[model samples]
Target: MTPSAVDLSALGQRSSAIVDQAGNLARYGMDDVAGAGVRSGESVTLQAPRTVTFPDGGSITYGALDHLGRPTGVTVHITPDMIGAGTHANASILPPGWSGNGILHNEARSHLLGRQLGGSGDLTENLETLQQAPANSPVMSGFEGQIRRVVEGGQAVDYLPTSIYLGDELVPRGITLDAQGTGGFDWYVRC
Candidate 1:
């Protein structure tokens, strides 16, 4: 026979051991507690947003902010099924599946998930700060729109995709797709 009432205190104590964004209660395999399940030598999967062309002809795409708790490279998946088809049961728009690597070796940055350079600046404040700055300032000129504010290692790390690079090439800072294989992932370097 077992105790009629189970003790949940142990589980409660370990709650901080993992993060549950969607309230999915289950054990996830992740080595580092700080880094979700992502780290160097680890593979991560992220869900990317749809890519849309802006009025200025530049395209805007959003995706995986972080894996575990570190900056990561993002991957976009465009499969036939993922593509949008006019079907009631199917997704109205193509859903992008973004995979990411835990480690960020690229010097270039991806603004997909950037934390403000300041300790407490958020998107609104960062934008406001740029808005109040002189027109000649980089932030005033345009960095505001390209940068995203996110927290990493308890500090804000602004991610800028346009600045991402591989070696010396301006490539996606996160991941770049191989030219030979569309199915392959590429860092967001500006190559």
Candidate 2:
């Protein structure tokens, strides 16, 4: 399909899979993806996203989310023209299943991802708030960030379909300590 004639719905649905909160991305970590490897081992080096100005005098950006759905280190690439939500900008959400290293990011990409870090599960998603976009956008990703966006051009669209997952596994928070003091046991409680 021509870039101009791109079906916002088709594209949005094709690429939006933000649901499944407890997926692999949530389990090990998005950064652990081969391409988005951490700077070090198992240490999260998430990036704080900031909007960049498109050549057409507007702004555009993308980001990733931590297990808690918080924005991590990443940025979606913006085409010089159609990549911003400024006062005079036009935008649309690409469908789900359309992950290319070009202008969009997949769950594995270290650059940008769209997870709903904050929002009412039903509505009032935070990603939309950050972009100052319409709630009905096809690129908002629902809450899991399935694929949603709002355009200044005033075309009606629906957000990409979304499904969230929950990880029931929990890790015990603990600290091991050993003391060389006169305790009967060599590894007695230090605290």
Cα RMSD for predicted model 1:
20.6
Q: Estimate each model's TM-score.
A: 0.21, 0.20
Clashes of 2: 37
All candidates: CA RMSD (Å): 20.6, 20.8
- Residue-level lDDT of model 2, residues 1-191, one tens digit each, is 11011122222212111212122112222222222211222322234434444464433333333344432222222222432232311123222222333233322211122333112122111122121122122222232121222222322222111112122111101111111112121111100
**Residue runs of model 2 more than 4 Å from their true location after superposition:** 1-18, 21-50, 61-80, 83-107, 110-191
- How well is each residue in 77-119 modelled by candidate 1, as lDDT tens digits? 2222222211121112111222222123211112222222211
